[model samples]
Target: MMTTPIPKTMHAWRKHRGNMEAVWEEIPVPSAPPTGFLVKLIASGVCRSDHNLLTNEKQPSWFQQQFTLGHEGCGTIIEVGDCVPSNCGFKIGDVIALLSVPGCGQDDCPECSRDLPQLCQTGYHSGIGQDGFYAPYATIDVRGAVKVPQGVTPSQAAVATDAVTTAYHAIHRRGEIKENETVFLFGLGGLGFNALQLIRAIGARVIVSDIKQENMDEAKKLGVPEQDLVPVGRSVRKFVEEKGLVGKIDTVADFAGTQETFEDAQYIVRQAGKMLCVGTLNHKNTVHMKIGIRKRLSIIFSYGGQTQDLAKALELIQQGVLNPQVEDGKLYDFPAVLKALEAGNIKGRIALLQG
Candidate 1:
């Protein structure tokens, strides 16, 4: 019953096969779907994953028409379809953050039944599988959205969709980190920093490894002891020993995903320890299979989190278990943002707040 004047076309940042992708340009607005609704973009996180997608030229084969590239977005509902189920809890004018993928709540579907539809390779995902936000208007699967509460900024809500959820899934869920256990975080970027917070909240210890002194300094400010921070040039094995963490590191949540970090993490994890690969790296890793097999290490490559995981991330934010930081200025200038990302000009997580 509620309505907002839907535009015929609006300025957006899109991804095509060629050079036209990153500029702020005009594109037709999408229509509401029978099982979904339309969202008016408010804020979206300019993630490193987007940079990875660009550099890797990772548009999937199923894509015919080009889709806009942002998946971590928050917006207000504009159009509602009658066929959308009441159980989905969507209504016009509600502020929400999108699920990165579609989890059709089909009872018989294996993934949907287990609340892990992100694993359903056949399913549709935002940005990767369909046109995502990064536009003035975009469609959202009704079951694939979570309400953003008033206390959270739209920018914070947007990053919570991916950065926060992914960190939570990799840290608390997959890592299975118990209190007092030590976690060595490789690369203190967006996802890495969030995992630091969650691990800290769990009363666990976190040792950080970063190439930048600024990143190491940031870790100190976040309560990681200066002694626990390891500069990247140093060997991962040597640092693990110097910190007295040799054979003691329970989990290594690898956000850097470089060959060096990947191989290093595998070497240092304790027996039965889990190493969660959360970052998207362009390089290939060469693991020492003999050492890996001997340690009985559990190496898991994880992608995005489930929709329920996003809901849990929101709850943690509401409870002050996490604090998301977004860089000031450079909000909504997509072309410039992409340039900064490519040049590595921006440090930490940055958000683009747009209409």
Candidate 2:
């Protein structure tokens, strides 16, 4: 039932061992897996993690030496695998958003059995350590693909796979932020901005801090009060103390992951407050033992989101509750986009549209 002819080879952005720069090279087109589909990518999102994959020397043992580098993608199914269930409702020409880390959902699998598939170590992590959707076409397992709804643009659907969904998972699930709680949020980058919107949707009072004044300004436009924004170059600890919020913040969502932010979070949150960490700007961070023990604070870390989280995130976007501030770029702009993201030049998320 194949109609349109797929090319035998296509160009992709990839990382090679020892090379800090991503290489644009041609590779053979992949065939659909028995339980997956062959998709022609319409849009893909550039993540800060993409930069880490290219430059970081130390990586997980599962990371491939060389692999295509894009995890967030939206595409159309060009071919369907024979093993894909008819009841799954996926079909050729269906547009779908992909989950980068769709874990092996075996009954005996530890993470999947616990409903934590995002942490599944047995499955291939696309774009993180495996060939992912930076090419014209990529194959995805049925467990990782969700059909994109009507009226959702490919760009919105693409970034929702990770950028929006990850924030949703962190704020709604891991942080367990309630409407009446006061949250001190650090960072306003791609994921941080989305977190702000989600926090607003929950009707929580959020105090935002970022190194960039533009981001803080953008937060104001998003309905965050002027007083809640920590001024650029102002010490977060001092700001909290001045505002009489020391030991008053109900939760600290540290999406900045800087040493300063970490230290500030420890000092500012109330006794027994929750610390939800999602960023990794500095992988290794120090915790004050006395401060932690005295306050009895709960430190929580979140990673990727589940398929259900992605679906809910998409629903929020469709309903206009979550407005992901994404800028559009072309697929070939991968290198420049990563450079800008690393330099903190890009505001909000950027989705690269496929030609």
Candidate 3:
């Protein structure tokens, strides 16, 4: 393949409105921010959340129309702006994770000061309010860029920004699973799989359930005991009985956020046990308040991963504590990316490398 010169216009997948198909078009390359840089995207992961936005099912007013779509991008710095430090760490060739979350530029903004702009109401998210890296070139504010460890490929680090790190936050921060506690996971998709590994590393007894046996088998290979993986429709009582957790388990992490999974989470944990809702269940799903009140359980709704969590997840991958083995359909390039995402055949995170 021959490398082409940097052009004023490049190819990108774009959508004009919520609930519309994304079309590839020749769009102008974004410019570097005064305190930011323009990065040439190497690869960007297609998450299920992106699918939702693409479909416009949960489209917010800010992302009204015509925006580039992608957040989990990794690449090298190409053009740095005036405020960016020449020695602020990144160089022309350094591989870095795109923060994707834009701050309000207000020093007093609570979310910005805490380095967690993901929660800022005034802050804009890439692929949402601003143009994301669905193109070869994208603009990113410098505050959230993190250097990737040596030897990690762009595909491997693509999920570092969201899927993997989101699990890191849900497990380590929200669930707060102790070394001795038993942790049950509902759904074994991208987030649940990483949660499974993180729980295992914490020395917590981990049990996972999913509709797909493939994910279960994958979990088993990650050192989760065969007995720990369960089928989706099976009764929670069976899992509790088989694990001998009559009253031993302390937590259940529900990543599916379906009504059935939420109810199962309630039944699986012991009295006063905690259940963290880490999944993006945006649809009409409901849990009986009576059951929750009766169990006296702690239900925590966890959203995106914290900024610091990404670094920890990257470290775990580097140290061999976590492994993300993605398949071909889950890692397609730009030409095929939209088709795969539109068909909804993606098993996990779908990645698109810049052409």
- The numbered model that scores best in TM-score is 2
TM-score of 2: 0.94
Q: What is the alpha-carbon lDDT of model 2 when measured against the actual structure?
A: 0.91
Error of 3 at 240 (Å): 1.1
Cα error, candidate 1, residue 184 (Å): 1.4
Candidate 3's TM-score: 0.89
- The segments of candidate 3 whose C-alpha lies over 4 angstroms from its true place after superposition are 1-5, 113-116, 231-233, 280-291, 327-335, 341-344
Give all candidate RMSDs, comma-separated. Answer: 2.5, 1.9, 3.1
2 or 3, greater by lDDT: 2
* Comparing 2 and 3 on TM-score, the stronger one: 2
State in Å the error of residue 65, model 3.
2.7
Q: TM-score each candidate.
A: 0.90, 0.94, 0.89
Each candidate: what lDDT?
0.79, 0.91, 0.75
Candidate 1 CA-lDDT value: 0.79
Ranking by TM-score: 2, 1, 3
lDDT of 1 by residue, 165-267 (tens): 8888888677777897988889788788888888898888888898888878888988888788887588879878777787888888889999888888887
Question: Candidate 1: where is the Cα deviation over 4 Å?
Answer: 1-4, 52-58, 107-115, 328-332
